[model samples]
Target: MRTRPVLKATEPWEKLVWWPKVMYEEGRYRLWYEAVPPDHWDPEIGPKLAWPNPVFAGLLCYAESEDGFTWTKPELGIGSWDGSNETNISLGRETVGPMGLHGASPFMDPDAPPEARYKMFWYGDATPDVVKAARRERPDAIDPRTTDESHVRAMYVGTSPDGLNWIVQDKPAVVFSSDTLQVVEWDALRKQYVWYGRGWSWGRRTITRAETTDFSRWPLPQDVLTASPINPEQTDLYTNGKTRYPGDPTTHLMFPTLYDRATDQTTIGMATSVDGVAWNWTPGNPVLPVGSPEGVDAGSMFVGIGLVPLPGDRIGLPYAGYSYPHKFPANLADSGFSWCTWTRGRLAGVHAQTEGEFRTPPVRLAGSGLRVNCRVQSGGSLRVGVTDEEWSEIPGLGVSDCQPITGDQLDATVRWSGGSKLPVDRAVSLHFSLRTASVFGFEILDER
Candidate 1:
């Protein structure tokens, strides 16, 4: 992993920043993240903030870039904070206050009406009045270890035409028995809105999921992904950094922060799902490990809610970094946001020490041409063949006819003697052979 973060909390009042969600649209990159100022509480409530409470909670802020790498936080002036309207505040204070801003997970919908093209799923409005009433109804409503649980911690929806300016929906979207990180995304493959957040199960902080055809009517969330039995007794999945795999819409990827409360350290783990509901956790260890002891992000490190595109056909994960005692107490000075990336199409790929091969599940293609991302060592080679469900290689596209792939590339097209088109219209699988090479992944090009 690269050593430094792409973004930092450099402003004087900037207490800490976390949970960044990014989107690339119309040739520009839009970033919506949760930023908390040292003095976030209202003046009336300032003196009452005796505990290690967030004086002024988080305010969802905005930043833009022609390229996703270089970001600029333009002063929107739409929200006021700490007696100043000088921050890049998108929605908070005077705009959508009483709760201020929390987790504003934004997504652009070309299919939505113009006024609602961009939408955000957020948490907050956990005001005293709301909290008191909620606590009366349910005594263990909030986690007292962090903040007051009485805050109405329901999920709310907001829409924007240009992503900066906003219109919060009048009604709340989803209500939870407790407060946790909420993330929402448009599931084009399923043609529904999928929501992932904190869910309690087996007496631990497990992950749960729900789907909604309409934004308002959601079925009760069910436990989808959870900590593995092999994990330590205190293992918990913190937040879901879920995003649709760009090339394969049918698959979903998530960076789940594995919380070991017993040890008090957090690391990022990888989870995959064909549908957004059930997940398959990658085994062994963290895909994105936490930093060293006493290092930034050593205490806790959660990945970006949105996975942006990067060069070399890779995916960029912009993450927020935090030091030890990963709490809101004492205001850890170095807490900020940073970034890391995974090779495209291969966040999880099989490795071949010397010579090995793997066969893909059957697929019927829109286009027969195959493109792959693979790395072959100097004396290594890679080959592909079309195979029947019974593992029999078809003619022309057989391994012997493959043009030996001898270089490292993200989009190297796999070819055979007769150009590698499927012989029959029925389903077929791909059999790959590698000698000192790693085949990341392959895609059947869409017919243009």
Candidate 2:
């Protein structure tokens, strides 16, 4: 918790580097994000809410990276910003209304059609006359923020062959009130299209989830991951950075940016799920905290869409950092992207003050040995035992016979008297006992 990510990128014209989602495809990494202008204001007129600034309200730009660390933006000359086709824009403002497109989430579907291989889900602002008429008819009778009138702020889908060119669906697929980041990802493990976006509850931010076999139709959104029961009632969570846990399909890892409206500070916190619909919000710690009290990210720190495994046993997570309160000043380009890392499997762990034990659910062993991701302190150690169906420890595989394991290792193998001789066909359980250590995860090592 409270891990740090280094500043990764910035753009001269990108005043507010908004929601960024990254996808791995074409043998490289592609980052799709929204860019806003430096001068942010809430105009009295609804039409001018986005200020007609092409780069501010509706600029979607693309960037590429080789290692998920260093990034480069290619000038596509696709959009006419400030007069001519002279920006690194992906979706041109000429094709759509200003600030119409936001929160662009690119997804690579293996089971998708060839022509429409790459797809995106984003907010398309279309001020409908029905809602407008109702507001005019009875201004005092409605609260637009909570009313279905705001549903005109809809979510639309677009397909692209190369993540650049696109064909947007003519009509809004699912209409909902959206302002913050919305994510759409293909859950390969579950074979479903997962949609996580913003919904209002008690005038604060809340996350709602919906699943569909087809992107065109989604059922009513249900509240899933939000502020835990223990958190202060006013604390808000934005952009549940949900991703499939590496090496384990049964677990989903999420790092939601927890924002405290009182302090205006944002940090990434951990929440876990066995099924994407239900979540267990980690209490009292952040997977990554906001920047320093006087630092660039002091105000907000929203983790980006992708999580990459980097060299030297590190995990790369991109995040956008910005100062708090959103007041504009001379330095409007202070907000940008940052890449952070962690020791493998350190996102969540069971800590032992002096000694503790935990037994994992039964698992079939298809490999020769077992490996564990854990860290052992200098004055402490860890030992793991295998149990049978009856919860009985096998001879030479009991805690007393285990080799005392030490060190911070991502894949430290468990050794017994006879290596690679554990029973393979039966469902066995791993019982771990440790002293002053943190056990992250375990895996059955295949015989080479």
lDDT of 1 by residue, 289-359 (tens): 77876667767787677776775566777777788644435265467666667777667666688999888
Worst 10 residues of 2 by lDDT: 1-10
Off by over 4 Å in 2: 1-12, 38-56, 129-151, 247-249, 326-333
RMSD of 1: 4.0
Candidate 2, residues 164-271: lDDT per residue as tens digits?
777877555565655567777788877889888877777778888888888765654667876877766768888777776544667777878778777666778878
Instruction: For residue 326, give model 1's deviation from the true position in Å.
Output: 2.0
The alpha-carbon deviation from the true structure for residue 6 of candidate 1, after best TM-score superposition, in angstroms, is: 1.9
User: What value of lDDT does candidate 1 attain over all alpha carbons?
Assistant: 0.72
Quick one: best lDDT, which candidate? Answer: 1
